[model samples]
Target: MGRNIKRILIIGMSIISSLAVGIIRTEAAEATSSFGSASYEWMQGIESPIGVYVSSDTPIYYMEMIVTYDPEILQYSSGGELEEEGRIKVEIVGEESIEVSQMLYFVPLCSGTTDITIENVIVQYESGETAAVASTSAPITVPLEEGCALKSLLVNGKIIEGFQPDILSYTLDLAENIEKVEVTAVADSDTTTVEISDTSLVIGENRIWITTMNEEGKRAVYTLTVNRVQNLSGEGTTKEEKTRHQEVEVLREEKEEGGNDIQRIVFLILAGLFFILAVLLFLLIRISERKRRNRRRCRAKRIAYQKADLLKKVRENDRQKEVLNKTSEIEIDVQHVTMIFKREKDEATSIKELLIRTIKRQRSYELFKALDDVSFTVYKGEVVGIIGTNGSGKSTILKIISGVLVPTKGQVIVDKNKIQLLTLGTGFDFELTGRENVYLNGAIIGYTKEFIDEKYEEIVKFAELEGFMEEKVRNYSSGMVSRLGFAIATIRDTPEILILDEVLSVGDMFFQKKSSARIKEMMNGGSTVLIVSHSTSVIKSNCTKAVWIEKGRLRAFGTPEEVCEVYEKMNQE
Candidate 1:
């Protein structure tokens, strides 16, 4: 058994050894941008455009830069504007990473190289804050010639001794046995092209010319002079020498044949051992798989028993009493409900990972309490706002009330059928036309076909997409879809219990005003509203009651002003 365990462990280690590693870095839902010196051909006696290039994972809104260059070597020609005292600050905006290039034309003062250093570089990505820095140096140099200068010249795959970009010609002598040589010439800029002549060598000196041309139609040639070594006078091998050479060759062949035989024997032994190990590993894995399956079955049975017991008790004691929520005035009741999610942190992103973790006994899964034993009661015609930071059980409670998710512990008593969760893209079919989706969404909301037909024109007008009804819903932008969804949701008489999750308004400013007025009109008509919003004013002004949740536990529940004042203060601190 111990031997089997060792074999199994070895096999497990070898399998899926390339398990995923590395975490993708991100900054608070903001996209990252980078800046680099743009490469371009710079020639003496001519102004060339060479500056910084910006690249980003997302579109850039704008950028402010300060570039300082060697003034004695490079003089500004045109392009970038001069700012305070000695600063050259340029702004480039409304372009993607591909199109974002800030170029400055500069005339080389002399035949030399100079560095253009960038500082205080700020790249703005979309509507995010404009504080991302990307500072890099761009070196400017005038080549030996427009296209004549070689970054490096190689002979037989090796750079010759005493070589520089300024040195345009070289002479190399080949060995007696060296029949041919390869000459590789690399140009200073990608805009230049290099062409070589025939590389084969003859008995005498061979001169080759490498021609280069730049984008500006300027051309230059670098010459290579190669002299092949001449053969020296030699006497022919004698008959005795030939006989000795034949004997040596024969002995060497015989020794090699014996060595090959031993190698074959060793190879066969190793292959046989590998086969045996593979068979053992296969058997061990199968046994472990069966055991793992049995364990899973037992775990699943235990969970089912727990769930069944919880359901039986919940059915018996669902009608809990709350003082504020009298029978006729009560709209919703959430009683001592707790939500706990069980899974690994990474959650075995792949099937191979799942198998590897299972065999290694890596218990990665753990419970996450999304909601604690919290209770809240909502009375009829009361607009209650749920206030909390992200992942504070606001949405979870809404889901539980809307019957989208059941709590792991405790019970909720409400007419789930009469509840409507007003959210964007709730029942949209992207493939269907906006006109068709209007009917589809209306049907899902329990609206009759005739009622939709009567209200179809009004809905289209409210969505402000009357011209786009014939277009596919997928073709519409996110804001357009939100408008259409909001329109369909409002067509129905307000639900007995309205569940809103960060969708108090939709569309542009004009449409948002309309949506807000419409919601207020519905609220005045006396309908229960339960909303989750980050807006403090929404809770203070719109909601009669507010509930504050912190880390899945209820922190405060009172009149909106009382609840929001403390919640906002805590957040500020």
Candidate 2:
């Protein structure tokens, strides 16, 4: 019993000693902070995980820390609970001297400097007492991005006018005598190096390239074009020469006109004398021949006169007759017309090419059908519109009606002489003056010289090109050419058939409106008109009848509204 009691006492004392040492350790314990990392440096969009640790010899029940950071600068992306705006609170709990670690994930919102602070740390020990701890911080840094781009570009000591850093192409037109031009460039960053390769200048086209690169081996390239043209009597090189060349020619013509007038008159007098002598000799011979064939000639003349009378009665007549037959007689009749073009795959550019093509037995060619078995009719005084997508044979059919092209498979029955086919970029010679083109176009339309002379000023006034009549047609702006063509084409106040191929869309918006009004007036004034346009609205508004062609075949023909509806639906699909 005594041994048993002694052993029990020893065991109790050992337990008490251990308990006292543990209490002592517990009383002296204090939490120390250790962060996962002291600093973080990374590029944008990289996610990093971090932790805050609290160590102690005694057990810990709970711990909380308030994390403070700029939300705009750092994102506590995923791990921690967002307690509030720009603040994240983390909590950890354990039993025995636990390492209180709360993992946090961070990502930089943008490239800059910032800091993450863990403060207001409260630790709850197993003894049921709360204690505050000091705070810790970690600094974050993101380096600036890298790019290879030019800041400035200079040519011949002059900075390019619009030197945007991102634009990769530039052009410079040098003068006639310029032999070499200095080229320089600067990069957007100091780390990037620029190299230029612009050593030679050719007569026509000189191309230069400026290359830039950064330390990371990323590269950007910029191109510059230098143009030099033949010094044609000292004029504008790249663009067409200023109008001074035309002005000089006009002055020369004026200087020479005075001396040529007398010479022309003298030549005309001598030519008239020779013509009279030749006619006198011809008439003498005709008198003898006529005596022998008088009876036969009279009979033939009677038959010819009768046939002429019958033809005139049945043939389509002038403006007055068109008005009388408005909407009654067919003005244009297209009968089973098909147009095919022969396109050569390999054209002979030289003698060697010709020989090769012949030797190889290569008759490589393509037959393109521009129109196929198309037939339509237009009545007198009806405004007809032809609508089609581009290259769908809209313009081809017009040329067929205007007698500019003969159909390969069929025919168009219309008064070819009365057709006034007005298409943009046609019927004007670029080498001629605008004034000369006016006369030439009028003469081709069957207007006599005297008639054109009487209406010359009216045409010029309508065209609004009075001061520029002497300029070459090539020198006129597109608007000016369109105006001139419109004026000349509409000079006749007759009821002839008029074919307009997108001519109403030739000018600025205001001019287009004006031209549309003029053509509408003509259409309503008993003129049989045919129009080809891409705009369905134009056809719907102006055309009394409509024809739709698609892929070289007639798709629809009816009222404008119905045809346009079908066409627009097809396009939508």
Candidate 3:
């Protein structure tokens, strides 16, 4: 029984040992380590002076290094020599303090890499005599990243030379047989970024190949450059003796897996909510679009019916007016036409003063009795024309008649069933597309949305901007905008009194002739029309009678020929 137990124990121990060795090999395979270098200094003594760099011409005996390490290792050792351009004496003050006590001369190097090292570092010994460790520091690179090119190595203060390259690529000459070759690039400007490939360089003269590529697949070749640095006399330091100390920081792997599952569940829930929201939004948008389309269809039908009714009424009134009267008659009755404009206090003392100043001081505003005791009446179907110089209130009169502006003092009375004030092209929001502005202007013209929808295609065709209908009115040429505006105004089939405001100025000869014919058709259909123009040709060609307005007063009101003759004579005077 004892022998059997021993065999079992031996077998179990061998198995355990084999498994432990296998696990150790696996862990080692997965382990990784990286190497880098830092710089430390040696003090001359506990109170001795150190050297530093300053912009002054004065010599500096004390220095400082931007070093890393907590309570840095400071000590003196015998097995070290600083690889500098000059010789420097190093002394140990405390048991762990190291420093340079004597000044050293330095030789300057021009081109090529220099070997800089600190030797004679005294460390702990296991079983050998005079055991020491070598601490290597990177050679100082000058001119930063863009200035100098480093392409060589140094070890222990000597150039251990005779190096050749396997591949020779160059912006400059290179040595051969480089090892632990690490090539790095640093940039001064933020415009470009630099990337380094190799970080290990061997100690020796070497020939290296360097390649640079831009974002555009453009390649540039730079010669592996080696710059020589001779001024290594910054400070000489003795190595500090360190006690053989091993510290195992108790790092407990918490294996925090519970919170990971919770985070995954939260992410899944959020993802599901987003998906549901996206689906809901899509459905809502689709429904809204459908409703908008239905409303547009209904509006179009209503507008069509209203346009037909307006055209019928206009025809019936035109017939009634033409047959009832043959002689021209005029009656003016304006209860009171008052216009008020707001003014800032700084502008003028009072409203009356502000008005006078506007007329004289600012020449842009012309004061006029836009309509003074203005009240008028004309026999049925009488054609009237209004003429005035720029600021003499011709447009103001039309705007009042069209109900776009209200008089501050009086009431306007018309014998006609309805008024059609043809404003030509005005009051258009250029930000909206031509098609969109059509509906807006239609509504302003007393046509329902339904009517605009019914004639939408016809309006676009008349404007001849079929392809550009959707383009913003701001983008339209002046001619295109005028045509579109004219098309929208005239397309409204309405009323007894048709008022025309210098609308014939736009369009070519063909369009003018076409518009004239349309006017004649409306007139013959018995519509009472009021025509306003500075053009004698339009007045004579379209109006049976005319009214000339000069300086906010009626200059002439008679047949077109008689009125225009008076206008010519008045202007000549």
Candidate 4:
């Protein structure tokens, strides 16, 4: 019985000790799960320095950090969830390490160093326990002075405030002639220095470089081009030499007639002078007649040449018409197409009024008729040209036919033919690289990736952008963009129905000629084409038939010459 009691006591002590150790471990875990300490630092921003960022290692479900700042030295303008007096509450969610940040806005009233403290940091855990963590941020230093920049630029004693620093160049037009232009640049700081490349102006475009450098070694350059026009008139001559020759001639004539019967001698001399003057006058008349006849012969030759050229063009046009009439098929037909646009108008000035008008449907709108029952037919192997003035619905008609725009009341029957619209600068992304944009444009035009891959090198070569294929299109010049667009639209695959809208007018002369030749080749290859251009010469030379639209109405549809003649007469009227 003594041995049993001793064993039972030993077991009881062991159990009690185990229970105490488990309790102590639970307490230690609870202590470790409590809110941890935090530290913060300052970061720079655009308007002001960013405030303290309080970071804690404990996984927190909910947290709120309050930042206390000196109102005299620093003032909060924005950021943080809630702001009241000098305290800001930043609430963070999720079971992760917590970081709370706010912007440190400075008060412009005073500039100095001040302490920004983080206080009242409350962190909550998943066990529904909340505790406050103590933290503080570093002091912020604010500069009392602003940075240096160009404050103003003066040209010829006149301040030019309209010049923008972002524009690297400026042009000044002066109607009055000037030999020199006086330029002065003023900086925000007195420590900045200015230099000018040239002070005098010359005829034509004169480029002057104006450079400004701050004390910190930051430099900015501006180019000023001054143009001067010079006067090219002769000066006046003196008057004394004009009268000496007349007095000498009179004395000589009086001496010659002195010893000879003066009246008879004067009569005889006058008669002979009259005969010589008459002969000279007759020869001058003959020469003038001969020159007039020569001019007429030259004009006749020119007219004959022009007539022969016209006849050749007419014959070529006739041949094309004959071939199209015999071998071509109908491609597109438009029957009484009409389009109208609804333009909404709202004069509401305030947000409240705008909301009220929108909710009550009180806005007014008007209908604008862009096309009025226009009709035309296109055939394969024929080139049709549409000509009209601005706002006469020429482009609108093309858009409708190309399926870019649907008519308001009429239907366009394309007869299952593939059509593509080629316009300058359309269907291009300026931010994408030229190579990527080529593929993108090809995809947009219904070409597959495989086809684009095959034609990629050819497209780049045709555009003359071999080395610039990897460069962004925004960096390209307008002519370069135009060339790339034209090359992509014309190469590899030719659509059955092609619609061109003033695309030929873009780029340089060489590109224009290249594009025109490609278009002619397409037309010759039996692709139906519809073109719109403001150039009458383009219409007369390239098109077999012309359609004239005036103020949303079809005025004439016939041969190019006939339709152009009628359109010209109407414009004259």
Candidate 5:
């Protein structure tokens, strides 16, 4: 068993060694072929031959090669002139040749037949002269019949073809990208049949095997690979080629104008500009129309309001006349009425503190001059509306009249009329039930418990919260809350002078109409109404006279229409 194992191991080692030696020999043979072989070819009468013929299946249009010798026989380098060694003067008269009639003959010198030969081809080393001996003395003939035709797919200048043997085998350099390829022998129409493998190939380096085909199969195979390299010329191609391409482009665009990419890009840019312009124009027109509509609506509302104002003033005039007629016999005395709010000075306070404070003194409460040097008198049973933009002391005047905020400079004298501030749900608790709140609010508004109890059913019915009375007030919607508030405010018997601070604007249109009707009803009952509103239309419609406040000062005081006109014109500027 041991002898059998040893024999098998020896056989395996021998096989591996032999295979390695064969591979090395094959590689060496290929390397020798790549550099090519130089041998003398004996002719019948020719002498001193210098050039050799190299034939391939592909056509040899040109050849650029470096001839390297053993340095002893022919010591030569390319580019520079040949450096002759010993007594040998082997010169290449011309390295180029063209085939005429399937024969490569020498170029004629003057009028005589030129022999392809080298003169005095002698070899003289350091010792003496010795005639050079030929290593290969047979005629070296690479038949043109066996050469391959090398050509490019396109005749354009982009692809340049030449010989390249930078590998173990000779090949063609396609110095540009090949979109498609085909290899054929004897042309397409030739009867002298030749064969190749894989005629069509992709755009890359590919091997094209050339061989002769018999009736059975293939023979005499010479595998030659054609390398298609990627060569990019960034000069935007040649002018002639670019012009031809441009002509094709123009024709393409003419055929399919809508599909032209350049035209499409241009069309898209134009369309975007037009779209932006159209949108801007539409926006401008819309804004202009809105402004026009607002002006027309404002004017129409203002005119309607003016008519209502005139009617209110006429009614107020009639009431004043009736009051004067009733009290003609009673003598009313005029007395000097003055009002002021004083700010006390502190000895310890500095000037900076005085500048920062509303009141100049540290010891005194801050006194803001809300209604400084302001005075107004209302006749009996007269209705007035104070119209102003935001922050014009309109609410301050209402507050002063309601006694919620004492004025720094003002006096009020109501002979026999009771003043009441009409606000929306002034005193109501959110956490408590509506029923509990009714009792709490009634007491706060200076009403007795018995009076509230009598009005409880009417308030609940008017607010429309019959079953919701037991529920917490916070649970109600805004509209429902406002409804309850309006009911609570109007449940009272009418006061002599009503001080309303734009509370009717709290709810939606339905509630606003209801509240307006209640206010009109109060005015009809000979109650003096003093109202404040930013809405000039509301003031003009509901009040007998209007006062315009501007920048914390009285700008104008007249009939509602007249004051509102002045305010509107100033706002337009």
Candidate 6:
């Protein structure tokens, strides 16, 4: 019985020993094959940690591993061999087990769960053995955070709120004089940065853009619009400024009252002189009456003798009256004319001197002789052209004839209220509409409202502004305004004498041709026209007589061909 029991115990002990050896071998194999493992841990709102560790059972001479994650969620900061595009390559060179850890910068672009994966993992052993392993980390949860957004927007130091979050546009209205504006924006979080486009406002309208950005590469944009309206009251003066002006007016009235005292005393002295003249006139009338009575008695006696002579005198007077009626018609007769302009000398060269002179009201004038004893004559039904170079007093003579400038030394005798002068774009109000300006300009030139109303459509048609008549004159181009002004001045009313100053050179070729034809038609209707032009061809073609002035003196006065020939020769010389 003892021998049998011993045998069974020995077999049991052998089996136990073998089982322990196999278990040890299996554990050793597992430790050698498992070269490394990877894991990652991330907390909310904090940088994540990624780690790779190798087992001590196997030593690696060189190894490469790749770690990848959602780039929008986490960005690799450091601790890798080569890192790009959310993937990091790690290399380990050692004779023992090693641990590799990488710091991943987190950007919470959204509130979601994400994973950091270890992919394409490769490990090479010192004994020329290779291993591949792939793994993924636990889900990392990101908390919801407010992204880039504007908390407040301020314009001109005034906060703007109560706006729809989705609507990023706003508008502001200001006075026209407000030429500048300042803008500021506050972001929802300190992690967001804000930028503004333009803050300088213009006269009419201005647009400003504000951009906000967060650390997660998210963006928000807002826009602002400003409209500036013109202030036309007080002629652009403010209410406070008008109050100050009233104070100034009161002081001026007080000063004028002091000067009126002297005027009143001078008026009394003039009244005494008029009284003496009245007494002298009464004495002269009594003497004339006594002389007339003596002559009346002698006239009765001679009446019978003068009857036959009176009949002969009446017949002769009748004949002379008929003769005188044929030669008395006259158009423009500018006789012995002289013009002088007095202007202040330019003595101030600097701003300080100019301001001082203005404050002191000091003035010194220099006289310039524009025309010296100039004389010209125009008969009825004639087209006279005045030709000259620049600053030659040609326009000055015309101005005198047209009653624009009075001659200092001579007389201009023309039919009263029978003249019209056309100057380019003169007396135009640019702020008014084209249609309104037509009537406004017509009133200024002595045209009755009924006459303008009758001719309004005619004038618009002539100016070719049918479609744009309601548009503002300020918006019209220079040529368009010139055309409108010329059309109104020329076609609105017909005058006996028409004066033109460089009006033929206005507008395009077609309009010039049309204007020339109209002038010719007026001349054919027995209306006298005087023109000042630089084009020799225009003068030669349209003028029956030409007057040339040079350096404030008449150089020639004759037919257009004769005077222009001389003028052209002078230019060549």
Question: What's the CA error at residue 92 for candidate 4, in Å?
Answer: 76
| Clash pairs for candidate 2 | none
> What digit string (tens of lDDT, one per residue) describes model 4 on residues 349-417?
998998898899898899999898676667666799999999999998888887779899656667445
lDDT of 6 by residue, 139-196 (tens): 4555333565677888878886555444556878888777778887887788888889
Instruction: Identify the runs in model 4 with alpha carbons over 4 angstroms from their true place.
Output: 1-328, 346-357
TM-score of 3: 0.37
Candidate 4: 10-residue stretch with minimal lDDT: 28-37
Per-prediction CA RMSD (Å): 26.3, 47.0, 39.0, 47.1, 50.1, 52.6
lDDT of each: 0.73, 0.75, 0.50, 0.67, 0.52, 0.69
- Model 2 TM-score (2 dp): 0.41
Whose lDDT is greatest here? 2
How accurate locally is residue 427 in candidate 4, as Cα lDDT from 0 to 100? 73
Task: For candidate 5, write residues 167-215 as lDDT tens digits.
Answer: 1123565655454555533322233245556744455777665443333
Worst 10 residues of 5 by lDDT: 106-115
In model 6, the Cα lDDT at residue 29 comes to: 17
Q: Residue pairs in steric clash, candidate 4?
A: none
Model 2 segments beyond 4 Å from truth? 1-328, 350-363
RMSD of 5: 50.1
How big is the positional error of residue 541 in model 4, measured in Å on the Cα after superposition?
Answer: 0.8
Return model 1's CA RMSD, one decimal. 26.3
Clashes of 1: 0
Candidate 3 lDDT over 1-573, as tens digits, reads 334544554565455445544433222111111112232222111111112111112222222222111111122211123333232334322111122122111221222222233333332111122222233333321111232232332332333245232122332223333334445443223343333444344443333434333343222223354432222222222122111111111122223465556656665665555455456545554565667757888999799779756855775566445524522342222333555544343556678977887787652433445654333345566666776667666777677766778876555545434678877556689999888899888887777988899999988887778899889999988888878888888886645778887787767777666666666676676667777788887788777766666666544445677667767776789
Error of 1 at 65 (Å): 72
